[model samples]
Target: MELKSHSPFIKWTVRLLKKALYIITPILVVSILVTVSYLKQTSEVISKSQNEAIWFVLQLTKEYSEFIYQLQSYQLGTSDYNDMLIQYEILWSRFNTIVNNSLVEHLHQFEGSITEIDHHFTYIKAMEEQLLQLPRTKNESSLLLLFKNDYDDLQIYLNHKFRLSSDDLGNKINAVSTLEIIFRYLLISTILTGMIIAYLLLRESRYHHRLAMFDSLTGIRNRLWLNKKLDKLAKNNQAFNFYLIDLDGFKKINDTQGHHTGDIFLRHVASRLRQLEQPHCFSARMGGDEFAVIELIQLNTSGATPSLLPGKLVSLLNSSTMISGKSLTISASIGISQFPTFAKSIPEVLKQADFAMYEVKQQGKNGAAYFKPYSVSTMKNNPLSSVS
Candidate 1:
């Protein structure tokens, strides 16, 4: 069977689900964006640092060759000796940056490579000293050539070692990439699970809310909801009539026919009350074998009596009910209490109505009466049987 779309709980659940989704969606999106941004930044930093270290090693051989060319130019009187001195200072600064300033230089393998570079620099410095002393040596060109060749071989060896280290960095980046993918999937899954939980909690909250307002057995408004309506009307200063009803001989019915039949009878009473399609009329099953109602009274200029709704209600209760194909007649004792006419407070009105209904019971069942402030003696003696 197709379900009706008029369920308040389902409507509320959908509203709550949408609200939760709205709250969490942006947070999850931002979190993933931040994570991806951080990963990209880390990758860029690692790549930049590794490339810088490799470039420094590669530049060393070129710097040495430049120094030799500058020296030859000085011998030929085409370059000043000051130019060669500046080149030497620049080369030494580059070497210091590779040895001490680079982040990758702290590794054990890098330390050995640095030591070898230092040894090579020491031999180069010794050759520069010898060339300075013998300014016009006949074999200067051949000696410079041999020095350049040895330094070129050292540069090639350092490049190979740096390539191996760079390969390791590549492997680490690959691992980080894998972890990033896995983390992204897990975050998405967690977000989905959280949404599911929110939906379930919304459903639970709606169920509890319904339980709080409606009667569990007869599906009418319960005592708590009825009390709330009474308080609201009293606070608003609206004139209304309150009715308190008690099922007469309900105990006898339960004893003879069992509690299950008693339950069915109560449901039947609730159904009859629900059929009253009057404006500003509300009915509630206060508890077992007892009910209450509130009907707003619109007074005319001629001042006709307040609606005789309570009398009609009592008549309905006195009608026969068909239970399991057997005609069973039930009667109710009803009491009337009017707002502002009797008292203003909701509790006082309820108390007066209850007393009037008890008076009906005193005069026998199947009747209704208006509340009157009877003395304690009169209450004991049924001297005032003002039933209508």
Candidate 2:
């Protein structure tokens, strides 16, 4: 029987690992989704900030141009100089906000931009003070007329500056959008890749677990599985018959015909044993030329013969097999031991059956025996009469 390879610590460690994978898979997916949502929100905030900066600078330039128009009209006696000074003061405040505000400083930080804006504000302040002190005269009108051409040229330059600022805003927004798309794609791909890897690992673990429970050569329950079955039955207080079988003269055939023929013979024997399939009947290949069968029976029967099943199995093994265009014949010596009758437990039952099979092999090579507390009658001798 195969003992469990994992210690208690190892088993718990493996179980914890499986549970951690289950827990982390969902967390990983949720984290990716949250990251995508966060990035999207960040991109929108950045775009909003850029739009605000562009709108502030353009609106400030437009108001400053209007103030220049008011100043020029005051020289023609069509506008009050006080009104022109108010507009100039408002433009100065707006320009100060755009240039000094931290939020849009990056957009306005051109070479000598602060010095140039300060020069404009200072010239406007000096003109406002001088106009307040002068009498209304034609000499003053000529002085203002000379500055009209400079105001027109400045208007043209501000319009071009607003257009360039708008274009830069668009490019920044586009770059932000592209980065968001790439980040979202990368997060989704990482989630998908993790899911695939976890699924494959789970499938491989299940496959190996299944392989460990069955015989690789004969495609039947192995000794470990049979032992586990008997243990379960014993736990349930169920009574069953344990048949231990050893193939007779199988070694002679294997020695002369090679292991290929030996494998064929073992498969044929396993197939024949499986033919005894019925409710509560199971067969197993217990390594090499040894095999076993388990059959559930009544707890306490009157005058029941334990050797009846072994006799049937012996007859089954005596049948002829054809492999590789050559006929082969083999016989088996089977021993019967009843659970809770000859032995009280699973391991004891198997040991008793093993002893009985050895007794049969001792008496003759092709017969069956029942393990008993006292000696019993000898089974009829049916040796391997032919092996062709």
Candidate 3:
């Protein structure tokens, strides 16, 4: 015999798995998000600091280049260049600002720049003191020739410093690249972890939701879930088919066969009900052997149920057979209640179905019944081709 599968356990496992994922997903997401944010801020800081350093170095190089170009006309032998002294003092002041500023953090590192800059100015300062005694308008081309030599000497030293500073900048840029790579990898790892945690968190959420709404024993919607759905349906003012199926003589199975056998019977019955072809049927456990199915779509209300399909709901219970040996027979006394036909309220509808189920047992066993007023229910108790 092909053994029947246990549905409640399978459904519960699926729900728990989903819930677990929910719990873990968010933590991963937030962590990755935080990492990406930190990396962006760090990259900005490093870039800004490096820019300030490069700007200072370039400023000194520009000033030195200009100073060297100006010296091309100077002669040092016979003339004192009075104008050159004023220009020299101004350039020195500017270069001092570059060296002394707090923005340039490491100063000793650029010693070549400092010494060469001062050497040229020291000689110019001497020239200026002497210029105070010479003619102002004369060309020092002959006299300036010596000044040119000292200036040339300055240029060679400045050039070497420029190369060193450039190398330093290149190395710093390399540092930026390395830092960027590290940040990128960190960000990637953070994102991956975040995704994993976020997934777990989401699963946890769903699992809790399932636990809240489902019966652990029967794999059917619990009372809480049914109430919620009923409220929604009522608010929408929609019509649906409702059924109450009570397994006849289930206590006999429990008492004679043991509780485990009863559980197996319940699982067997629940599993069979789940395989019904009706798309709109949803089953719920109203505690114990009482189970309910709600046909959310057009119901099998062939007898003029408003906005619902026409068909008797009798086969719903008859269609499922309990697992008995090669073929154990499971029978249900199905009571069907409809919207408007029974009562408009959810409670009233369910009560009518419950009442109708016992009504069949009163008449006879092995039959389905529709709840009708005691005065008018002539419909046979034996299961008929869906209530036409």
Q: Using lDDT as the measure, which candidate wins?
A: 1
Q: For model 2, what is the error of residue 353's alpha carbon versus the real structure, in angstroms, after optimal superposition?
A: 0.7
Model 1 bad stretches (over 4 Å): 1-76, 80-202, 277-279, 298-305, 359-364, 372-388
Name the better of 1 and 3 by lDDT.
1
lDDT of each: 0.72, 0.71, 0.60
Which digits, one per residue and each the tens of the lDDT, describe model 1 over residues 1-388? 0012235656686678768767776767776777777777767756664676567776886787787787677667788767866876777666666556656443323436777777777676667665555455645567667677767777776776577455556665775687598667858766785778676777767666767888878878889998888888888888888889899888988899889888889889998998884678988889989998888876557543646576677778888988888777878888778787766698889988888888778877677777756621112122233333
Evaluate model 2: give its lDDT. 0.71
Q: How accurate locally is residue 50 in candidate 1, as Cα lDDT from 0 to 100?
A: 62
Instruction: Kindly list the per-residue Cα lDDT of model 3 for residues 1-388, writing each as its tens digit.
Output: 1112444564576567656656655654665566566656655654664555446556655564554445433444332344455445556666666555555554434545556665656666566644454456454454356655775675566555445356644665566566567667656765675676566667656666777788777676777897887778878866776767787777877787778778877777766666652666677777888777777644454754442221233444444444455334545676667676556898888888878778767766456666666631423434443343
Off by over 4 Å in 3: 1-105, 109-165, 180-195, 297-328, 376-381, 385-388
Clashes of each: 0, 0, 45
Per-prediction CA RMSD (Å): 9.2, 9.3, 6.9
Relative to the unseen true structure, what is the C-alpha lDDT of residue 20 in candidate 3, on a scale of 0 to 100?
64
